[model samples]
Target: MPKFLIQATYTAEGTQGLLEEGASGRRAAVEQVVSGLGGTVEAMYFAFGEYDIVLIVDLPDASAMAAAGLAVKASGALHTRATPLLTLDEADEAARRQVRFRAPGAQGPAGA
Candidate 1:
């Protein structure tokens, strides 16, 4: 399973709905959506800054996560951003891989 971090900000109408339904209702709704997409919500929280809410979820794959994001966006109530989270082991594996590349202003192999 792949993990995703979701940061969202509510529109005026969405804020009004939030006030009416409250946080618990919103959390449950999100949980249900994620579950329907074969994912689980690891954690969710309300924030007081650039983002109104944040969530961590474990989903089956990128497409599943994208589906979840698109569904939310389609509601026209909130703006959402989803970022894929890589585990430390995955980072380590990436760091260990080797390849060849040229820096800016540099030529190709052997400077040819």
Candidate 2:
């Protein structure tokens, strides 16, 4: 499984609905949706400013993540951005891989 960070901002209509339903109500719905997709919500938080809510989630794979994200965006009440999270070991593994490339205007090998 892979983890994801979801940043969400509510629309005017979404804010109104949130007010009516309350935070707990929305949280329950969020949990249900995530769990239904074979995923788990590790943490959820509310904030002010650029984003209204943040969620840390672990899902089976990228396809499952895309399904969950697309479903939320389809609702039209809120907008979401999903970022894939990598563990430190994963980052190190990526860094260990190597390849070569030439910068723009740099010459290739001397052979004609």
Candidate 3:
């Protein structure tokens, strides 16, 4: 399974709804949605400032995350951003991959 970090900012209408239903209520709704899509909500937090809610979830794939994002955004209550998350080992593996590259305007071969 793949994980995602989702950050959400509620609109005025959404904020009103949140006030009525409460954070736990909202969290439940999210969990339901995620579970329906074959995923699990690992952690959820209600916050202030730039973002109102943040969630870490594990889904079967990126497409599942996209589906969740699209559905949530289409609701018109809040805006969302879903970012794929990589575990430390995954990051280490990525770091170990071999690649040769050169910056633009840096003459000739990369090591030349």
TM-score of 1: 0.92
Clashes of 2: 0
Per-residue alpha-carbon lDDT of candidate 3 for residues 40-106, written as tens digits (9 for 90 to 100): 9999998878999999999999989999889989989999988999999999998888767778887
For each predicted model, how many residue pairs clash, with residues at least 3 apart or on different chains?
Answer: 0, 0, 0
Q: Model 1, range 1-112, lDDT digits (tens) per residue?
A: 9999999999998999999999999999999999999999999999999999999999999999989888889998899999999999999998787757788787774322
Model 1 / residue 105 / CA error / Å: 2.4
Tell me the whole-model lDDT of each prediction, alpha carbons only.
0.93, 0.90, 0.92
Q: Identify the runs in model 2 with alpha carbons over 4 angstroms from their true place.
A: 102-112
Q: What is the lDDT ranking, best to worst?
A: 1, 3, 2
Tens-digit lDDT string for candidate 2 (69-94): 88888988899999999999999997
Flag the better candidate by lDDT, 1 or 2. 1
C-alpha root-mean-square deviation, candidate 1? 2.5
> Candidate 2, clashing residue pairs?
none
Estimate the TM-score of every prediction.
0.92, 0.89, 0.92
